[model samples]
Target: MIFKNRLVMFLKRQCCFCGAGFLFAAIAFTGVATAQAGSSQPDVRISLDQAEQMALAHNRTLRADLMLISESKANEITAGLRPNPVFDTDAQFIPFFSPSNLNSDYMDNSAQFDAGLSYKFELYGKRKARIQSARAATVVTSSIISNDERQLRYQVATQFINVLYAESKLRFAEQDLATFDKSLSISQKQYQAGSISHGNLLKLQLQRLLFQTDVTSAQVAVVQAKDNLRQLVGFDSVPQNYDVIGKLEAPQPKLGLMDMEADALKSRPDLQAARQLILQSQSQLHLAKADAHPDLGTTVDYTHLAGNNDLSAFATIGIPIFNRNQGNIAKASAQITQAQEQERAAEQLVLTQVRSAYARQQSALQVVDLYESGYLKEAQQSLSISQYAYLRGDTSLLNFLDAERSYRTVELNYRQALATAMLSEQRLEESIGMSVPSGKVH
Candidate 1:
């Protein structure tokens, strides 16, 4: 009976252990399946505005630039802070080795304890100059950060357009492939019916291969464009497929060239930053001049000697005979000249950018209009008519294929032109440092 009980207990324990192990395995499998499902979920679709917002929020470089503003503000705070007074204690002329001369009292004749406090005073408005210089530096840093943000916005906008263009190409390639598949199907039927020669059927198959190659290349291009956008938006991984939802058409700007140039000079962050640099240089020059004047230090001391208390005050001043910050003063003045020249150069560069982008924008608009107005419609109709005629045995396969290729090329070119137009407009906005009102598209 005891052996039976022991065997039964062992069997029950083993069963329990096996059940637990199976449960753990099941749980692990469920967890892994859940993870995979989550990972395979579709990507979060985003519009251009959303993408820009995300980039501004998460871009590492922009975040680092923002930190510089804080650092500059901290420097300003440091510059405005008053100098701290120093305290010192000294015990002098103590008769330590001569016991006979040494007095038992703590305040003896041969020993002296002195406590002193000293403070250095800034002269010739040096503190005010230093504070002003620091404030000007902060402005320069802030302007630089603004310029960086403007550039980042431009980058995100351009990349978003590229992704849109790539997606359009992929769609066109897929449609072309479908058309080839239909032709291949018809060719196969004709070949089997002995209505077409083997060589001709082989030629059709080879053409299908060409379209397949194009489809593969388009797919790779789309992936690369998306990857570039992801990096700009600061995404670590994008496992699911996502797409941009926006038209490739350009929004016309209402402002003319002269207005744009005026706005750029007034609002362009780089120009503002350059001007702020000039102000900073001027402030530094003032500070350098102030540094030629010396600081005065005053001290108050209290001493106890042989039970006698004495108080004294002294004043000290620095001599400005040598090293009166001549080098820094000269450098500061030269920096002001450099900053002015840079500001002028920046203005010229802005003008060049605006003119170039405007010209490209006009050219792109013309091309887009030419295609959208008549060329694309004609090519598409030609392809449709040729396809129908070939199906009814009224047209040659070569003529039908040529029409198909023409239509595809025209459509792709139209999309490219639209993308270019939109990108140029974006560049113009970046150059002007502001968004222009949308005008009627021609």
Candidate 2:
């Protein structure tokens, strides 16, 4: 009886251990699922303006361009500084071989010390020309940095729009799949009840597969778009599973083409940089001409020789006999011409870009308006009517499926049109080097 009791206790212990192990496993599985859910969710959501701010703060290329401005400023500072005066000291008649001839005192009989200071006086306003040239170069660098910021802003905005478009498509695909799921369930029941044929059920199943394919493609596109945006904004600043908050709707602006062109000419940083380059070249030409004049170097010296002290002063100048900066002057003149031509080219390019973007924007707006006015509503109504008719035995499965496909196509096309219009508007802003005021959407 005692042994039997012991066996019962042992069995109870075994049951307790088994229960504990099961409970542990359940907890572990729950934890894992929670972690997965959290990982799948987006860590951050940002608007277009916030995205632009992040990009400006974290973009490596933009940061590098900003550093160039500091470097140019440093050059300007260096150019404004005058040359340091030279100090000279010498010991003549030093007896290194014979210790007896060496002098213990600093100014002894057998040794002589000479010290002098020399300064080079820049002639023909050389220093002034250098300072001016450096200032002009700094202006060029500043303009370049400004242009880089503008371009970066445009890139970020475009990528942000792309992300929004991809997300919309993904949502549409999922919704379509869900609608098919309901239809598929109904079709399966009808087939089992002998109300629908096997062929019709098979067609519905195949249509579900197509929707599934679309969902997969849209998911991939979303991921790619987000990755591109993250890269532009900076990898560290954006999380892998972050979401963008923006619509693909284009905003209308009241500004005309001529106004845009005028703004572009006045505000385009690249054009300004090009013009600054012309000024820099002119300054360089003046500097080169100044270099043709010789500089004056003046020196003064004191000597203590054999207990006698003497002082001397002299000035030296180079005669501009042969090399009078002829080559540099020619090069600087040529650079001025080149800069002017480049500025003109930049202006033309800006105008062309504005026109192209305006055309695209107009076309996209038309398409979006057409879809929103009546076409999209009609497609949806047709699909709904066909679905109702099929369920009521008034239409075939083929007709219903055709309506579904048409609705999906129209919806996707509408989304694409919206994205295109938004992107074209961004391009217009970039070409004009300024943001147009947002107006009412059509």
Q: Global lDDT for candidate 1? A: 0.82
Error of 1 at 65 (Å): 2.3
Q: Which pairs of residues clash in candidate 2, taking residues 3 or more apart in a chain or in different chains?
A: none
Per-prediction tally of clashes: 0, 0
Pairs that collide in candidate 1 are: none
lDDT of 1 by residue, 1-442 (tens): 7976676566566555556555554465456447546657446778888888878888888998899999999999999998999999999877777766676574476589999999999998998999999999999899889988899989999999999898788778878888779877987898888876555565576566556666666766776887888877777433345667786775664567777788889999889999999999999999999999889999999998877899999999989888799999999999999999999999899999887877777788888889978998899899989988876668887897899889888988898898998898889889888887765433
lDDT of 2 by residue, 353-397 (tens): 888877777788888889989999999999999998987779998
How well does candidate 1 match the true structure in TM-score terms? Answer: 0.85
> In candidate 1, how many Å is residue 358 off?
1.0
Off by over 4 Å in 1: 1-41, 192-195, 236-240, 440-442
Taking all chains together, each candidate's TM-score versus the true structure is 0.85, 0.87
Quote the positional error of residue 105 for candidate 2 in Å: 11
